[model samples]
Target: MELQDHIMHGVFHSNGFGHLLCLNGLEAVAGSNLSGRQIMNFWDHLCNALRARKVSLNDISTKRGMELRLMHGIAYKAPWFGSWGYKFSRGSYGVIQPMYEKAIDTLRAMPLCILVHYLGSSNHDIPIIFSRYQMLSDHSLTTLGDMFQFMLELKTRMAEENLLDSYTGPGMFVEQSCRWSPKRIEMATRAIVEALKRADFRWVSRQEVRDAARIYIGDTGLLDFVLKSLGNHMVGNYLVRRCLNPVTKVLEYCLEDVSNIVPTQDPKVKTTIHQYRMSKSQLMKDMLYLYKHILKDYPSSLNVGILSVVPTAVRIILDAKYFAKEYHEDQHQARVEIGSEDKLSVYCTIMLRNNNINIEGTTTTLPPLLPPFECVRLRRSATFNELMVEVEKIFRDLYWGMKNLILDSVANLEANGKDLVFGQVEVGGKVIFQGSNKGGIGEEMMYYEGGSNWNKVVVCGCGAREDDGERMVSCDICEVWQHTKCVGIPHHQPTPQIFLCKRCENEIVTLPAFP
Candidate 1:
C-alpha cells in the first residue's frame, strides 16, 4: 500500500476496534495500529529513511522506539514528515505534553519523517501504562480495587475521546460488539498478570484478595463500571464500598448444583455449594436486589438498558472464584442466565415495586403501565410517578413477553409434534408459567421461542442427567413434559412407559402427583 494508504489503515484500525482491544490488551501491543508483520514493514521503511543520518536501528519493538510512536502527536511535527503531518489530519491520538521542551526539539532535528509519517497515518491508541493506581510509584498493577478505579478513570477518558457512547447497532453496548479479539485478549491477559505481580497484598487478607479476583473474573466490565461510575449508591455511599462489605452484603445466595443429584447421592454424599445460584430465578433475584437498592436513589441509571447491564453484572458474580466447577454441573446455567436476561430483566424490575404503593415524592398511587400511544397529564415534581409509569410499562411488556415465549415455543412444538399445557394455578398473585405445567422436570420452562428460534429447556430441578439419557419422557398428546423419573415413586417400583403431565393427564384418568 502507498504510504498514505498505509497510514490511513493504521489510523482507522486504531480508532475503531483497535482502541477497544487495546483497553483489554486485545489489539496489537500499542493501541490499535499495525500487526507485527505490518509493523516490521513500517519499521524497515523508517530505518531506510533514517539510514543516511546514521540513525541505524533494527526495529521499532524497543522501548525507546515505542515512546516515539506513543508521543507521535507531538513528535511527528518534525522534519521530513514532508508537511504530511500538518497537511493531512485523520483519526488521531494525543500524548500529554512532556515537561522538557529541549528533548522534543532535539528529536525534531532528527530525520525521523518516516517514523512520524507512520504514526500520523494510523490514529493508533496506546495502552495506558502510567496511572495513579501504581502503588507508591512501583510501576505495577495496583490492588484489585485500585485496578477498578483505574478502569473507571479510563472510561472517563474514553468518554472524553468520544468512544464510550458511540453506537454500533441495536442492543450492541459498544462498537466492535464489545468483544475483544483473541490476540488482544492474550495481550491484555499478559499485561494484567504482569502488573498484578507488582501488587503487594501484605495489608490485605486472603479472603479480600479472593473476593476481588472473584468479582473481576466474573464480570470485569460490570464491576468496574458499577464501582467507578456509580458514586454513592442508593442511600448508600459509593457502590463499591456498599457491595464490598460482607457485613452489609447484598447479592448473596447459596447456589446448589442439584442437576446431578441422583437418588443415591441424595441419601449418601454431602453436597457442596456456592453462594451464587446457577438457577435463573436466583440470578434474577440477585440482580433485582442489587439494582433495586443501588439504583433506587439514582433511578435514571435504570433508564439505561437494564436488561443488558443487569445480567452482565450477575454473570460476573456467578463466574467469580466463589462458584467453581463444583457449583456448575454442565455450564449450561451460565449460558441460560446470560441469554434469559432480555426476557427476565423487564418483569423482574417492575415486580419489585409491587410493595411500594406511592412514589416517595408524589401523592399519586402508582398506576399500571401506560400504553406507548397513551399520554398522561404531567404534574410538577411528578418525576417519581413518571418513572413508575415507565417501570410499569416495562413490566407489562416483559410479563406478557415471558408469556409469548411459551406460546411461540408451543406453536413450534405443535407444528413439529406437540404443544405446552398451560398450568391453572397462579403463584404470588401472578401467573408463574404461561403454559400450564404445575410441576415440570425442573423449574425451568421446557422451551424458549421468538420468531425462527426455538429450543427445549432442560430443567435442573428434575435431576435429569446432563444432556445424557436417564430417558426424559414428554406428553404424547400436548407433548409438554419431561419426566426421567417419578417425583415420588420408589426406585424399586417399575417405571411407566406411556405418560402425561398432570394438565395433560387430566384429559385421561386421575392425575398422579405432578412431577
Candidate 2:
C-alpha cells in the first residue's frame, strides 16, 4: 500500500494518531483475524465519500493532504500525539519523551515485525520512519539492535579515518539528526544503548545521552545542570593529570578551574604549580589541533592526547608520594656503604639517637674476599669473561644513578649513635675494608655501593616465597622486585607486594613506583 493510504487508514479508523492504539484494538477487541471483507467495506465507504466530494486519490496522496490529515489526527489525539508535528516541523529526529513513555505503557504496542515490515523495502519512507524511531529512543530491543548495527559501522568508519577520538558517539548521533527524519526519543535511546554493547563501543550514561538530545531539542536545563555540577568540584588536578590530551568537552571542565588554582607560599612548589597552569592554559589550542588532525585523515598524527587522559593523571598520583613521605619521616637512617665499583648494600644498626636513625650494634659479621686471579691478570686485555664484568659495571652505574636521587633527598636525617664495644673474633683472611677501631667502639666498614650515585638498590627483604603463590618480581600490578628485608617488608616469606610496593600498598611512600 502507498504510504499515505497506510497512514490515512490508521487516521480514519484508529482511536489514536499513532497506529499503536489501532493495532492494539484490532487484536484485542476486533479479534486476531482482520478480514479483507471488513477492510474493503471501510475503503468503499471512504471512496464513496471522496467521490461525492469529487476528490481524487492523486489529490489525497499529495504531500499537503497527507500532512493535514496527519496533523488533524495528531491534534485529535493530543494526549497521544507524541509531539509528532512539532518534531517534524522543527526538523528534529528524536521522539518526544512523553510519547515514548505512553507507547511502552500500551497494552499491546506494535509488535516488532509489524512495525518493521517495510524497513528494508525501497518504498518505505526513510525520513518518516527515522523520525518516528528517534521519538521512540528508549523503545523495544528489536529496533535498538538495528541501531547498534548502524552505529558500529559508523564508528568503524570513523576509526578507520582516524577521527574516532575527535567526536563522541553522542556527538555523531546529534550531527546525524540534521538529515534524518524525526524518531521517538525512546527509540534513539534504545538504539544508543544497544550500540554501546558492541566491542569497542562505550555506552554513555543516561544523563550524557539526555544532554546530547537536549542540545538538538533546544532544552537548556540539562546543559545548565551539567555545567553547575562540574563547577562545584576541584577537578583541575584530575583533568590535567588524568586527561593530558582532552577533548573540547573535557577542556570545558578544565577551563572552569582556571580562576581557582593559585601559587602557594613555597617557591619550589610554586614553580611547579606555575608550570602546570601554563600547560593547562594551552590545552584548548592543543585539543583543537588534535581534532583537526583526526578530522583531516591524519590518524597517525592523533596521539595519546587525543584518545586518553588517564595515564598522565596516574603519573601525577604516583609522584605525589615524594612529598607526603618527606613530611612524616623527619629522621630515619640506615648505614649505607659506597663501593668503588658502584654497588650498595644496606644494614640496620642498633642505635637509638633521638634526632636520627642510628645503628650502633656491631654484631653483624662480614666475610673476607680476595680479588679473583682472572680480574688481576685480564685487566690489560680483557677476555670474554672480563668484558662481561665491565658490562655488569655499566648496569650498576645506571642503577646507582637512579638510587642516588632517592638517597640525596633523605641524606641529612640520620639518627644518633650509641658506642658499643664488642670482643673481636679471629679473622680468617684479608678483609675487603677493615676499620681502624678493633673493638668496634668508634666505626666499622659498612658495605655500600655507588658513592655520589642516586641509583641505589633497595630490596623489600621478602625472604623467598610470596603469600599467594605469586612471585614477587613477576607481579606487574605491584612491581616489587626486591626482597622483604631489602624493602622494609617485615615478613618471613614474601608478603604480597601490596603491603610494601607503593602502587599496591594502601598508603603513599617516597619511592617512585611507575618508573
Candidate 3:
C-alpha cells in the first residue's frame, strides 16, 4: 500500500470503536472481539522486529518515531490521542506509559472550562471535588489530583491578577450536602417568631414570614430553602401552628407557646391537637373530634381531601344563615342537630331581600328582588363518614349566591347598625364571624376541585407520605407507624416482636434482665 493509503487506514482504525476497546482494554478484554488481539499481536511482533534490529523501545515510542510507525496522521491532534498512545505503547512497556504526561497537559488546560461551567458567577463554590471535575471522562485519582492542582493554580492566578477579591480564600473542597445550616435555622426561627409576634400571635402569611427572614438571610433562594427545611419540624415541635388561611388561601403561621403545648406520642392525639387550633367554632371542633373517632373505627372513612374544605364549608353555611336572619325578619330558622347514630344534620335558608325602594307621597313600594329572589333552602344529613362529602357538595352549590347575599347583608348591617367590620363581624370587640371574601367559598370550592392534599397527617420520623409504599413498623409502645429503615431495622430482617421508638423507649424505664 502507498504511504498515504496506509496513513488513511491508520486514522480510520485509530478513530473507530477499535480504539475505544484499546482505551478500555481492561474492561473490554472479556467482552470485545478477539480480532483486536491479532492486531495487537502484529504490532507487538513488529516492535520486537525493530528491537532485534537494535532499535530501542524509547526511540520507537518517541512522538516523531510513533508518528512515523503508527501513521496516526492528524488523528494524533484529537483530545483522546494520549489514551490511544497509552494503548499503543502498552504492549512494549507493560505499564502506564509517558502518554499520560500528554493527558496531564490536556487536563491542565481544562480547569478554566470546568470552573466556568460548574461554578459560573456564584462565589459559593460547590464543595465537591468530583462534582467540579465531572466534565472529565477519566476520573482516576491521579487525573483528579492533576485537575485539582491546575484549578488551585488558576485560583491563585486570578487572585494575583486582582480578578477576585483579596478577602476571597481558597475553595474548600469538603462536601456541604446538608439541607439546612445552624445559622440559617436559628435566623429563620427568630424571623418567624418575630413575624408571628408582630401579627399579635394571629395567623401570619408565609410572605410575611419570608419578608421578616429576608432581613437576616439576604438570598431569596437560601431563605426559602431554610423555611421549607424548618417548617415541618416547627409544627411537630410545637414551635408554630401552620394553617391555610380561609380568606387568603395562603399558608399562615402562628407562634405556639411551648409551655402551653402538650407533648403526646399518639399520632391521633397529635393530629387532633393541630386541628383543634385551626378550628374556628365549637361545632367545627366537635365535628373534627367525631370524624377522628369514626376514622379510628373505620379506617376507610379517612379522606383528607374532603376534611380540608370543612372549615370554609362550615363558615359559608353559618354566614349565609346569619345573613338570612339579619336581612329578613320572617326568615326560616337555621337548625343543626346531632342524631342518635352520630349523624349530623344542617338546615340553612338563604334569602335575598328586596332592596329597590320607591316612595310615592308617603306610600312606599319595593320592587321584587333579582332572578334568584326565591330563597335557597339547603339541608344535608350525613353520618360522620359522609359529613365532609356532604359539606363539600353543599359548599359548591350555595357558594356564589350566598356570597353576594352575605356581602349585601354586611353592607346593610354596617349602614344601619354601624357595628360591622369589613373582614370580621364583631360584637364587644370580639370577632364573632370572619366575613372576608378574599378567598371566599368559591375559591374553596375551586381548591377542592384542584385536589389539594393539605392537612394530611403523615407518620414516621422521616414524614413519609402515607401512600408511599415504604416498609413500616408500628412501635409497640407508642403505636405510631415508622419506616423500618428509619427505626434501624434492615429490610431482610424479620420485625422484632416488641419494637419501641427512641422517644417511647426513653419515656418508659426497662427493668434489667436477671442472670
Candidate 4:
C-alpha cells in the first residue's frame, strides 16, 4: 500500500490483461539492468498487491471507464513498449498522454493500494464512454492527442462491424429494474403516435407503432433485428446507419410514452389509418423476408469464431459455441436439465480455398477450369475445388430464393395497385436478369462480391431513333431483344427469332422458358 505500489497499480492496470507478464518477459529478453527474475518478482508483487481485490467483466459496465483503467495501468510503465508499438499511442485520445503524465507525476507520492484500487475499479467506466466517443465524435486532435487515434479508429471499426456489442459485453445498457420506468414507457408510446402523425398516418393505427416499440424497447427483438441486418453488411458502417432509426425510436418510446395519444376522428385520420395498416402489412412482409434470409443463409451451424487477419493460408475451423445458442437459454427453462456436469464437445473444421483458376476454352465452350497453359498450382488445389463447388451451390440457392422474393414483392405491389417501376432485388450474388446477346443467357452480368463492380444492362428508352438498315437485335429463339454476338447464333443464318435489320412486331418469339 506504499506510494511506489500505488503508482505501480495504476501502471499495471492500464497496461491491460497480461501486461505484467508480457513486461517481465520483455525485460528478460532485453537483458535490462534489472535481472529477469527481479523483473518477474516486481511484476508478481504488483499483481499480488492488486489481486487483493477481485473484479470480473460484469463489474465494468462502461467501455470508457474500462479503457481509462487500461491506460492508467499502461501509464505506470510508460517506457515499456518503447515508442512505436504502443496501441493507444495517438489521436483524439491524445487525452491519454496528459492522463498518463499525471499518473506518473502523482505516483511519486500516492499510495500503491489507493492508486490501484481507483484505477482497477473507478476507472472501469473508461471503455464505455471512450467507445461511445469513438463511435460518435469527430473532434480533431493536436500533436499530443494524436496517440489515441487508434482508440477512436478501433471503436469506430468495431461499431461498423457490429462487434461493438461483443466488445462491450452484456448488460452494459440494461436497466437495473429489468424494464423501462413508467415515465419512459409512456413517453415511448406517445412518440410512436406522434411519428405516425408526422408521416400523415393515424393514432388508431398506432398499434403497429406500439408493436414496433415493444419489439425495439421492451421485447429485446430490435437488437436481434439490428444484429441480423449486420450479417450481410459492413459492421461499423451498418450499425451507424441501420440502427439509428430503431435506436431513436426505442429511446423515444421507452423514455417518453408517446404512442397512446387519442386524436380527433377526422376523415383524413381515417384514411391515414387505412394507409398505415397497409404499409404496416408490407413492412411485416419485408421483415419476414429478412428473417428467412438470415435463417437460411447464416444458420447457427455456420456461426463460428471469427479470425480477423491471417498472413498464411490455413484451414477454417468452426466451434459449435460460436454459432449455436445455449438451447436452455433460448427456451426459457422449458427443457429438462440433465446431469450436473455433462458438457458436450462440439467442434468442426472447414476447408476454405486459397487458389485461383482461369477459365479458358474454345470460343464455343464453357470450361470449368482455366486452360492447362494458364493453370497455376495452388496451395490447396483439392480443397479449392471443393470450396468452389460449395460456394456455387450456395450462390444458386440464394439467387433463386432472392429472385422469387423480388418478383413476389413486385407482384404484391402490382396487386395493391402500386407501381413496381423502380425496384431492385435483394440478392447477394450474380444477377440473372433476362438478356439477349450471342451467348446463351447472353452476357453474364453481376456486381462483384464487394459491390466493387457495376455490371448492369442499359438500354435506350422507348421511342429512340435508330438506323433502319442496322442489323436488328433479337433473341435467337425467344421474343426478347439481344445483341447478335450474345446469343451464340451464327450471324450468317438468322434463326426464326433472330431479326435481319427488319422484323414485324407480331413475330412470335420462341425459346425455352426461363428457369
Q: Among these predicted structures, which one has the highest TM-score?
A: 3
The 0-to-1 C-alpha lDDT of every candidate, in the order given, reads 0.26, 0.26, 0.34, 0.26
TM-score of each predicted structure versus truth: 0.15, 0.14, 0.18, 0.15
lDDT of 4 at 34: 56
TM-score of predicted structure 4? 0.15
Q: Which ten residues in a row have the lowest lDDT in candidate 4?
A: 312-321
Cα RMSD to the true fold for all candidates: 31.3, 36.5, 37.5, 32.5
Q: State which candidate, 1 or 3, has the greater TM-score.
A: 3
Q: How many angstroms is residue 467 displaced in model 3 relative to the true structure, after the best TM-score fit?
A: 39
Where in model 4 is the C-alpha error above 4 Å? Answer: 1-42, 46-133, 136-515
Which digits, one per residue and each the tens of the lDDT, describe model 3 over residues 86-168? 22222111112234334323433333223323332232222122222221111211232343433323433442223211100
* Pairs in steric clash, model 3: none
- For 1-515, candidate 4 gives per-residue lDDT tens digits of 23322212223332122232122232223434553335545654554544312111111111211222222222333322222123223211112344444433332223322222222233333222222323233231111122133342343344232422211111012223434443343344333434333443222222445455453356444433322222111111111111223433532111111112111134443222110111323323332332232212223332323211110001010000011101112122122122224311111111112212223441332211110011111122123233223333433343321121111111112222132111221111111211111222222222122121122221212211321122335433343443343334576967554343223333334434679
On lDDT, the candidate that comes out on top is 3
Cα displacement (angstroms), candidate 4, residue 140, comes to 19
Model 2: per-residue Cα lDDT over 1-515, one tens digit each = 34322313432211101121121212223443543335434544553343221111111111111222221222232221222222111101122334333332221222323322322232233222332223223222233223323332333344222421111112112323233322332234323233223314232433454455453445354344323322212221111101212334332212111121221124333122111111221332332332232122233322233122222222222111100001101111111232344433221111111111123542433232111111111122223233233333432243222111111011122211221111110111111211111222222222222221112232333232222112233224444455433455465665663444554554445556995
